[model samples]
Target: MNQTTAGVADDLDPDIRRFQREMAAAYGRYPDFDRLPLTERRRIAEEVRAPWAAGGPVMHSTETLNVGPFGVRIRIHRPDARQVLPALIYVHGGGWTLFSLDTHDRLMREYAARAGVAVVGIDYSLSPEAKFPRALDEIVSVVRWLRSEGAAHGLDPQRIAIGGDSAGGNLSVAANLALLRDGDAPLSAILVNYGAFDRESVYPSYERYDGPEYNLTTAEMAVFWANYLRGAQDFSDPLASPMRAEVAGLPPTFFAVAACDVLADENRAMADRLRAAGVPVMLREYAGATHSFLEAVSISPLADRAFAEASTWLAAQISANNDNDSQ
Candidate 1:
């Protein structure tokens, strides 16, 4: 099959298609990757992603620290020498089963540099081992910690946002909802990049883009959901599926939707729901983009554009928050 029709639509951006091919080539090396043990699968995944995570803009300083009772490890990337900086608490996506702070290092650095804010990537407990609420709780704890003690590390506690891609995106919203429920202070913003919001209902985009050509398949998502949930009962929990939650009072949200992704329609629905709830929303859909396309920054100009756009929005949100605080 040609690049256009290999695993996605004919309109798939050529650069993104090349990214898919590169990813496929990486996975091709491990023909039995799916059959491997989770530990082995993760090892291979990290190795596969190492090159993509390399050679990004160097940080002014990077620090790794363990926080909370569960000892969640977080990597903080400061873009400049500023003593205090706004922060984006980033969660890395791997179906809640794979990927980590290291695998997503470059993406975090890119955001930190581009947005001129600190980017904090957390090493939340993974699924099947930690399960739902565990990762969500860790994220919530990190945010709380930043609120209480972040100033010691040069973070502006009042100007904090949380974001992630795929599974991480799901956790970002879940954590925000949890904080809201507990009557904790609200976040400044939420950034979601093609988040998997609902696991119970399969949307139209799922069927439309239900092939490996798009980089994410229905079967793979099923496995991911299975790994993250304790049982079928968890499906209805808003924390498990923020799409089913009461989204009122959420802070401003920016959605980076990928047109060819299975999560596209749901992302649109989410943006609509957030708007209906009276939440400020900025929804941008990238034509011909697929899930996880942001990682293609090294090879795709589209990915660079996406990052730049998100960074600009993020910077503006933080700036707006700062201005309000000053006023």
Candidate 2:
């Protein structure tokens, strides 16, 4: 906390402030995002990717699966295959245009080990290159793939969950709706980590946190949304913005939020919508954390506690499958 950015305070959560300063010092400042080429931007993000505890099993397998014209890479983190286990099909978030499987590998591994459920991370195509329905279609495709072929990988397709952070969180909601529309079985649960549910960004959190202090700004968010969409018309598409979707019939959900994030209010509103729709929802907002703070799994206690709470919740949901299996 000794180092202070212009708008940030010296006494803010000492851990969060320290994490923010270190991340800025490593990756270029949040505002520099628009200046860098998208490719190089992703590269630098990879360079400073958080080093989450490598406490998982030694052996892990990752491979690319060409489904249709798109070749999506999926990495599986499983501890054992002696018994068919519940699976979590996860999507990583980078504003829909940044990071990849490698960026989220350690975080996925940590969950797989800690929760004792097999974790499957999907490496879907990015946007600006593939806009609108493309990424959403790809995520739906993987969820469909998991439902049909997961048993071969020792995963119980009948009992599965989907989870993600940020843009990936938005995709998780969209994918759940897409699957439900196709009349597929409901997902056991879904975990949304600090997701941007609304396209409008009209939430007060967006305005309040719209500064250098929080590490996410309205300017950078504009770029991400611009890159993800086909145009302004796409904002009306529920698949593009889950906050606009008919949220009824959604499975049980867990939303993890940062108190000081532009996306915070939208997530809160989403929980309200889900509850009003009779969908069970759990919302956890950690104090003093910022967007993408979970990436600080290796650094901040807030992230550690958030991760533990999320994993424990999902683990309980996955274990509930046993009662159904018995019946």
Candidate 3:
């Protein structure tokens, strides 16, 4: 509520400005996301949903895809035109425990429409029930299936891109590496949003932005890590924690970070590493925002802008890659 902070908040569009204020008033103290009771957690999530569901962009699409090990169900958002389009494989965030395609339908729809591509939202198996490697396996299977069957769905295998928020973001990166290591068809690009990359909280952003309605926190992240990693040995596995893996020769990447998220530094570090490895990387950090802002599509312009940047970057990369291939 100081002069400088207030000034920055004022810069947001009116709806986002109000949302920022309301979010602060309600949970400004940074309560641990994992500490809240199930009922309370659902309540807060619903509260966040009201605004967007009321007046937000409507994404049109065909049937949902039910393709995975154990019959995992995923939703697909397709654009209107008939010509085959590039595919954007999307994953939703819930610390690998809570969320599903339903929780993030709107966000995926918006991404598909604005980015002008087909978006496949994967409902990867959750934790405590299925555990690690299960979700990862499911996502990889679906992507491979998409590559094999994408033509039937009017999707171009050459323009395949993976994207997701938070835990989903983590999966997106892991999926990219999984495909590359296994020698599966290469993805053209990746869109990682506030991904849970590093397990350790050594990054300054973890300490600096570790508070209140800003969304992600160190304590909450620990809970996610615990649920994700049933044992300490799992952390060392490259498939489980991508930041610990070798990222060389991966596809082009687009990373978006909320300045207020505790994971910001790790994301930045990942970007630096990817760039050093000679991969084309686009990293955009939105100021005065917190984690999950993109899900708040109705209110946060930062979310909209971040999506815009990702879409633009993807278009350019895909086009350039195509141009080069035809040479």
Identify the runs in model 3 with alpha carbons over 4 angstroms from their true place. 1-17, 20-55, 319-321, 324-327
Q: Give all TM-scores, in the order shown.
A: 0.96, 0.91, 0.86
lDDT of each: 0.88, 0.79, 0.74
* Candidates sorted by TM-score, best first: 1, 2, 3
lDDT score at residue 11, model 3, on the 0-100 scale? 31
Give the poorly placed runs of model 1, Cα more than 4 Å off.
1-8, 325-327
Winner by TM-score between candidate 3 and candidate 1: 1
Cα lDDT of candidate 2 equals 0.79
Residue 284, candidate 3: alpha-carbon lDDT: 91
Q: Which lDDT tens digits does candidate 1 get at residues 18-129?
A: 8888887888887777778989988988888888889889999999999977788999999999999999999999899999998899899999999999999999999889
List, residue by residue over 1-327, the lDDT tens digit for candidate 2: 011245565434678887787766665445566477878777777777644323434434444555533556787777554467788888998888888888887778767766777888888889899998888888788777788888887788887888999998999899989887898766888989988778787888888777666877777788889989999789798888888889998988999988888888999999999999988888999988888788777767888899899988888788634555211
Q: Write out the backbone clash pairs for model 3.
A: 30-212
lDDT of 2 at 295: 74
